[model samples]
Target: MGRNTRKRRSPLATKVIAGAAALAVGGGGLVWANFYASAHESGPSHNRTRSAGAQVATIQCPDVGQKLRKVPRGARAGVDRELAQLDKQITEAYARLASTRQAQSGDASYVQNAILGPLKSKRTAALDRIGTNIRRVGGNTPQGLGRFAECRGMGVDQPDDGNGNAGNGQDGQNGDGQGEDDGQGQNGGQGQDGGQNQGDNGNGAAGPFAEDFVDINDVQPGSRDLENGFAANGEGGSQGSFTAVCGVNENNLFNSDNLIVAPGVDNGAHHTHDYVGNQDNDAFSSDEDLANAETSCQNQGDRSTYYWPVLRLQDGTQEFDAGDLGGGAEGNVGKILKASEAEIKFVGNQRSDVVAMPKFLRIITGDAKAFTNGVANANSSFSCTGFEDRQVTDKYVLCPEGSQVVRTSNFQSCWDGQNIDSANHRDHVAFVQQDGSCPNGFQAIPQLQVRLVYDVPAPTVENGQVQNPYAVDGFPEQLHKPITDHNDFINVMDENLMNEVVDCINSGEDCQ
Candidate 1:
């Protein structure tokens, strides 16, 4: 595909152009550059008027998975499989949309008829099956799921946070709707021939637009508080920490499988993920499979799995998966950047003591479709080593010389104390509140924070264009936005190791 600059749209066609999307890999909440024309806009009125005729860049579909939260256990496998199908349907539709730009330019309703219309039909069926699956087990089915079948055509510059508001009135970041599943799962069996051309979208343009980046110096020293009330100098409260050594994927263990979110479905993620910790993970891995699998962690007692989307530089390098399903074939192109460091830490709550997480406790922190879903669960933190105080959740940091890209995420630390998994995948755990206290009745668990550092060259913004943009792999509909960064984890830690973590945090001792 060619990388030509897009021509301006005609005013009359503004009525025809429509919507865009994200679900970055991680357990990395997906973050896209959400446009708040009112707050982010600069320059003359002519520029604003010129932008009125925006071209439809991608399709935005309602994340049905985020809505179904109480599926019965008996119906989960069936429901999950159907949800996976929904993701697959959207991927195919996006591929069609990406590959049909020329035809779209000539026909006002080409996208509606050629891509979105058929997509709705497929989604409607899958949603229907979801209801049937739940009802069969005497569970209450989600209502009005059929309403999500219709996907809108989102424009290149228009950033809608699923609501009418653009940018959520908070510098283009606001609210949380549990977001997408960071597009977990990959069909290790699929072809790696870059079967789909997501990079150029058949229009010869790379993504992240020039809007997804901002120089770190320009980002205000953010007020993000990292201190969770641990004793400063041998003080009280749970002050201990457990740092698990999970190498930065020294073993080329890469996949798109997300057992927690979309079990039994192959190639479910549709985007590549770099995995560490549990070595045996895929769409079909059972709890037993994970517990028995090899581990990347130094402690053999921990078989936990940690995975997130791989970061890539848009420097025209095709990785080995370039032609495979989750790689360049799905629009995740470029050279994969290995983490200079992948640090996994488990810390305690400042307000209360920690408890052992149930075996197989599954957690997915951050939202994958936050670009389209809004900031509700947006938890990805991007910063530079020296500029750690200035972290941004929606935009990737354009670090200065001597600085490197850093991605950090704090998984939900408050567990419901009963179920290990929830229907929306979020009901089981809650984030610690501003006061570092868990919600009422929710027990505090060792908060897991995964930090990844990269030495990729910093992207430079010249004349409002990014020269070397780098981003996490994400769903095609959700443009590779930094806000879409997310991460996933499954606790396969043995009972003894789990107890040790709890004791370490409770005893105020930093342990291995």
Candidate 2:
């Protein structure tokens, strides 16, 4: 997509309300301002007060190392069944909770007491049962069975407080009828001016969706020109542009069941992913593992693992409705809904014979946390088809009538050429020049751009015309507001396909 063709909108507006409850001391007529403000502010204040009933409990995982035991061969089926049951239970519980909230018109106490409270208890019991089954099946490790169970209590009852606490206030406070403090340091008795600030939490924390790392303001528009070996007259039949399609990675929900960060130690991507390509790709999978595994890619040799967060329709059949299931709990309400579209493409490269990407090279692009933080770039584009002028950076993009909402992520495409991986999963890879060439000391690689098209239902679209954005699962409530989204990929390409890709880039020919 051309950046110039789209019209950009300013960041969302943040409204802060300031109120001061005054008290007159004795007969002297001295005044004191119990001033409370809600604008995005920085630093800390000693005057902050939280309600007693609003505290949320935190859950931590047990420490476990790599090399945890996999499910025993004979017990695999049973383990799968048990896990699936737990998944169904949790999904249904959330669905019921969602319904109750709607029925109560979002009465916080009713939702918490009648819905979430009971659901939490049921989930806890379900998790305990799953844990018992895991031990019986010989998958006995903190990272293995325990990790999956750990996810059962992974959420907070109250919404996120800008300062990392769990509270009910919109900007940050417990839901109880209590005053909110902006946490900004006190300037005697004066109140700070409130205004709309982009990508900043009221407490000076980076908004959940902010992309502070990349300076989007400095990114030059993408170009097709190849640098490095090209002559002024354009030698070697260079086309100045190239595009290739990586085969669609179907919703392979269970191939590499392990996760990154803590291989073998944890269940892969605590929230699931729609995986494609390599069969053996996982946190523990080595180059040899990928080399031996079968693949779904058209090029049997391409074993790269491509994946991203799953998208769901807001009001689809997957939505939670009362009595959908036999029990009081609904089935799969807040669960993973089937994706309508999953397409991955390689769009930018200056050269034809790019070098093969190193094995086990991990690259994460975009910030998943963007839903909570504001994006660093105004160009983190979000728009519905046909409504090109109303581009936004919010985590959720509400499409207009007769329009399909889409999210396009353009990843950096310059490789350091020497290191297969880096400590941060970035560093080794860099963005190509605006002219579509590799930077100094960095070799050109195909730019990975992924686009996800969503089919949200009518209720998800506000007023049946404007889009009603929602956040990806597992993000903060604030994230449900319009914000940024991101994706991750690991290089498990077959050596042969990698060579072919390089040859195509260096030869200046575009091929799928």
Candidate 3:
């Protein structure tokens, strides 16, 4: 790659050339001197052209006795070699990023899962630079040469989010501090070793998986993952790992958009994540899976939202119920509380006090001898409704990410608590408290409402047809994929049409 300097022909050089020509007309010794001087000052006009061709052909001389220098082919090759190595490096970095994502998101530990997507997106962006550079590498323009030179030594630095190489931390900070069950270090999690392990329920669907978030935009039409499974394996793709597929090729298999379930999907024949085959009467079957399937077909629908009927229980008897507040009811500790308009008003009024520990309440708790921050074991008691005088003598509760007091009734509340006992429960629990007692000490039994998040992919579209077989039963056959229909052509056509109409009007003709 070479730079083309579009140097303007100087007026001084033009003047000198004209003057030399005039002197040459006199046919004296001054003719040669003026001619030499003018040539020296102006150099070669052909070499100074604005085009790239002229630049490669230009010969530059340093001084009166110096030899004319030409660009060496070896130098150019050396630059090409450097760029090639950078290209290779970028590709490998992208691969590692993709693999890391596969390992992290696929039912791995919580810490590993958070970093994968950001890392993948970063590497993808870096790889995108290679495409732009590659195109410039083919040109002889100045920018093209500069870009090639810039890429001569480009490489990816494994991203570090301030956390040391110990790995597995959101913000690269220390993890939730809940160490592994096997007593492994930070990096020694279940989904490690390039995502080979399965059966680890880090925080995803119950199945073997890869470590990448599948973008719904990338799912291909008539793909199997969406059409067959319950919400594209929950992590957003088949086993949470995305296989790279050509966007336009008919045979390309990595179509993420194809993972979306269409509207009105039937669950009886839908595919499940278990490759070993479904057992125990569709253990994976659920209503949310069916609803997510239906969302795919309708453009206005959301793929993630799901609806289901509420079951009510009262006095050891179970029955069907309406919705929450908006005709809904919630089950707490084997009792179904109807969420009527009056009950909704009552709950809403108490929410500000019940949700998360109020600042004033926290100050009171902080001063208590029983309450300590990050301390493993200390038991006193924070004042609450039920356990006002009850002393929790031996339990240690760890305040995790969502540490807040939720007031339910005048005598009931909920909070996140970690049972410090190594034998009973090590993980944080969304405990609910009732009758003035929080779960651990002052909290009720049905503490926090736990909502498991899953990434449900969107439907795919090809040849103007929507592709979301996940919304239906049976595996869908692959369809033709065309990614660039709107941006490249539709936009251009819109502008063209506008211009044509404007032209016709200007020409005094009726615009079509």
Q: Which candidate's lDDT is highest?
A: 1
1-512: candidate 1 lDDT, tens digit per residue: 11001222123212111122232332022122222111122332111221221234556777888888788999999998998888878777766665554455456566677787888889989988999999999988777878988876554443455555654112211111111111212111111222222232211232665567767777677555444322122344478999999898888877766778888776677777888888888877889888888898999999998999989887666466554556655667777898999999998887788899999999998887787676666788889988877877777887888889899988888899998999889998997776677889898899898889999798765444456578888877777878889999999999999999999999989998
Question: lDDT tens digits, residues 345-377, model 3?
Answer: 001111112222211010000000011011121
What candidate 2 gets wrong by more than 4 Å, as runs, is 1-258, 316-341, 350-354, 371-381, 386-391, 433-440, 458-470, 475-484
Which scores better on lDDT, 1 or 2? 1
lDDT for each candidate structure: 0.69, 0.39, 0.19
In model 2, how large is the Cα lDDT of residue 451?
A: 63
Roughly what TM-score does model 1 have, to 2 decimal places?
Answer: 0.82
Model 2 residue 201 CA deviation (Å) reads 24
Error of 1 at 52 (Å): 6.0
Ranking by lDDT: 1, 2, 3
Better candidate by TM-score, 1 or 3: 1
> Candidate 2, residues 1-512: lDDT per residue as tens digits?
01000112122121000011111212111111111222321222111232222211112121111112344444434444444344344443333332221233324354345544554465556556645655775665334333333321112212332343433233332221122222322111112323211212111111122221112222233321222221221242233233333444453333213333324422223233456676665545656776787776777667676765544332222222111121001111133344455566553354433556777676666543332222332123455555534444432443446666666666666788787654334567776554556779997676666666666542321111121123343222222223335566777766776666666656656666
What's the CA error at residue 318 for candidate 2, in Å?
5.7
